[model samples]
Target: MDGVLVDSETYWHRFEDEWVFAAAIEGGDPAHEEVTGMPYYEIYDYLDREYGTTVTKDEFVAAYQDRAESLYGEDVRLTEGIPALFDSLRAEGRPLAIVSSAPQSWIAIVRERFDLGPLDLVLSAEDIDEPGKPEPHIYERAAAELGAEPADCVVIEDSLNGIEAAVRAGAYTVAFRTTHNAELDLSRAEVVADGPEGLRRVFLGSE
Candidate 1:
């Protein structure tokens, strides 16, 4: 839903570098990878245990919540041709979903703002009992909710954690190229799409 559906990764990284890392941590340079694709609240927990943060968990969560409205509402741009892709998939009776590490509220704002069309399901890692991304539970749950076999689902993901989760869930994973994760290794994915058109081809089975 983030890097794959919208150009929110840049803003998210900016916020992490400028606000979260700069304001919360002391000296060492922090890579966005340290927390990228994590649930916003989970990032705080990670930071608290790893590098130690200056803010309380409540403060960290609240700050992200406060920024989310503007981030999704104004800063992010929907990916080009995605609506067309969604239409094509829906026409084929595919049950589409946006399974993310984001909390439901954050996903809700983006869905409402972008008019993402009729998604069969919108899932959050928080909806499950286990920890978020890099874990297969959320993806497993999404497949369950969709009434589909996990091995039958094709998950398009742009983050390592997301790809790992999807793969572990026994789904076919397509690694998506995005500036945010462009340099990271994506060999675990079954396939890789280099652009929106590449993604479209994958969805349409043209490649």
Candidate 2:
């Protein structure tokens, strides 16, 4: 949900800036927007190659998980209109799921706290047993779990990786510009909106 359904990019930013850019890699954080929807493992690998992390991949992974548990619930801020949107979707019985790069354990807490039980499914990078964003595996798994064809799904994403993943899965995609991620090109997405409130068009089928 970070940088997508909710405003948790900064939480991720803290994790990246501390563990990723500071402790692990000597280089400053990349824009990171292009990689937003990517899985943490893929992200760690990319940072290792591009920024030269001294820590082992496993060490980096552990550090991220530890910090993630601390940050998940407290720091996240929801995207505007998300509650109403979910309510509407639930009312219509349109199958919906949150397919994200965030760890499943962490997402569970947030989901429960937010009363997101109506979401028909929740698929994390962990569920796919594959790499994360930009790969389409997560969303593909989500569609399967929800018993929806890829073409029947509509993905709401925030970053380039999320958009690309949806496109690869053959689903309609809407990119939400919550953070300043315009630096990450998103021309491939079907729709780019100002925020979650702007996403009413998808449910209304006005787009």
Candidate 3:
């Protein structure tokens, strides 16, 4: 949801650069991709395991929660043409969902703020006990929740970890290009879409 539904990646990356990478993590500076698509709690775990953490898990989570209140509630903007695209897909009788590594609270903020709802499902990593992105379990759970097989789903993601998760889930993944991911490799995805307009072309056959 960070990049696909709302332009939250920029805000998130800023936080990572200013605080997470600089102050919270120890030793080497980890790449943003290393933790971008994992749940915030899982991010702390990953960092602690890989680079060692300077802050306690509670402190790290609190910092992210504090930043998220403003980032999702105020800073992020909805993806251009998304509402219209949702309408178009709805008209075609396609089931719609949002599968994200974000917690349900953060997803709720974005959904309520943008009035994007009446969706078939809004699955968050917090909703399942399984590991988050880069692991196929979340996407697999999302597909199951939608009453479909993983191979029958079409997942749109803007992070390498997210794409990897979907691809591993056996879905046809679309790598969405955004300012935050332009330099990241997205080759594992079955399709790469340049932007919101590219998304329209992929799902609606128009741009």
Cand. 2 Cα-lDDT: 0.76
C-alpha root-mean-square deviation, each candidate: 1.4, 2.2, 0.7
Across residues 96-115, which tens digit of lDDT does each residue of candidate 1 receive?
A: 99999888888888888889
In candidate 1, stretches whose alpha carbon ends up further than 4 angstroms from where it belongs are none
Question: Among these predicted structures, which one has the highest lDDT?
Answer: 3
Quote each prediction's TM-score.
0.95, 0.89, 0.98
Stretches of model 2 off by over 4 angstroms after superposition: 26-29, 205-207
123-205 per-residue lDDT for model 3 (tens digits): 89998988888999998998988999999999999998898899999999999998999998899999999999999999988
**Best-fitting candidate, measured by TM-score?**
3
lDDT of predicted model 1: 0.87
For each of the candidates, give the backbone clash count: 0, 0, 0
Please give the range of 10 consecutive residues that has the lowest summed lDDT in model 2.
198-207
Model 2 residue 53 lDDT score: 78
